[model samples]
Target: MRTRTRIAPVALAAVLVAGGTMLAAGQAGAAPKAGPAVKATCYGGAKYYTSTAGGGSSNAHWPATGTWAYTTSNCNDINVKSDVSLSVKVCFKKTGSCNGWTSAKAGVWTVVAKDVLHGSGFYLQFNRTSSSKGWIAY
Candidate 1:
């Protein structure tokens, strides 16, 4: 009886140690998987890109000051839309270069650029002669 009890404990401890080692080894050998790709959206003729994942309708209107708010993180795309033909400008910073203007026709959602924005922040401006106009970003 003494021998049997001693052997059982030793065997149990060995098995537990081995199992723990195998678990550690398996985790160490596995490569980390990449995250899901972010989705881009075009609404009412404007484009928006975000790392966040979800589905919903987005409002399309220029900011009250004509400047779109953006984060310091990566910006994946530039989108533009309007009720009539208009020009759009995207800048790295508020005071930075205009990058150039893209012409977007009325009622047509357009992607001016994509995968072009890196980690730098950016904003959008809509150039329209008409009093009625709007745009949005994500």
Candidate 2:
């Protein structure tokens, strides 16, 4: 014959309490959840300028010359706005190499940057089929 073993209510209560305490302790000793990293803002204030019909802003003059503005510590993209629809791009170095033009609508924040390499320096150029005005933030 098999003998039946039963846990008393008091003993069962102790087991549950101990198990809960162990679980709580383990969780407390675990590492805390990490927070998201903050993105770097533009190094300075936004730049405002005007583009004449079929013309563009002067080459790579913002962020000052010889300075890298889109590195790890700097901005990777820029925010742009305009009074009328326009095109924007990043022109780098003396070769006049540029990223594809990104279209920006009137009064909207359009973030632009592409094919950006670390340590590469660039400036914003705004183009319009007609005269246009805009401001850009790195």
Q: Pick the candidate with the highest TM-score.
A: 2
lDDT (10s digit) by residue, model 1, range 19-114: 999998776565233222222222323333221211234222234334455532233565554556766666655457666678878766556555
Q: Please give, for residues 34-117, the per-residue lDDT of candidate 2 as tens digits.
A: 111122234245568555344244442344445435433334556677777767787776456877788888897677774355
TM values, all candidates? 0.43, 0.45
Q: Give the CA lDDT, 0 to 100, for residue 38 in model 1.
A: 27
Candidate 2 residue-wise lDDT at 55: 26
Cα deviation of 17, candidate 1, in Å: 42
Off by over 4 Å in 1: 1-62, 66-68, 71-75, 116-120, 135-137
lDDT of 2 at 95: 54
Q: Candidate 1: deviation at residue 118, Å?
A: 6.6
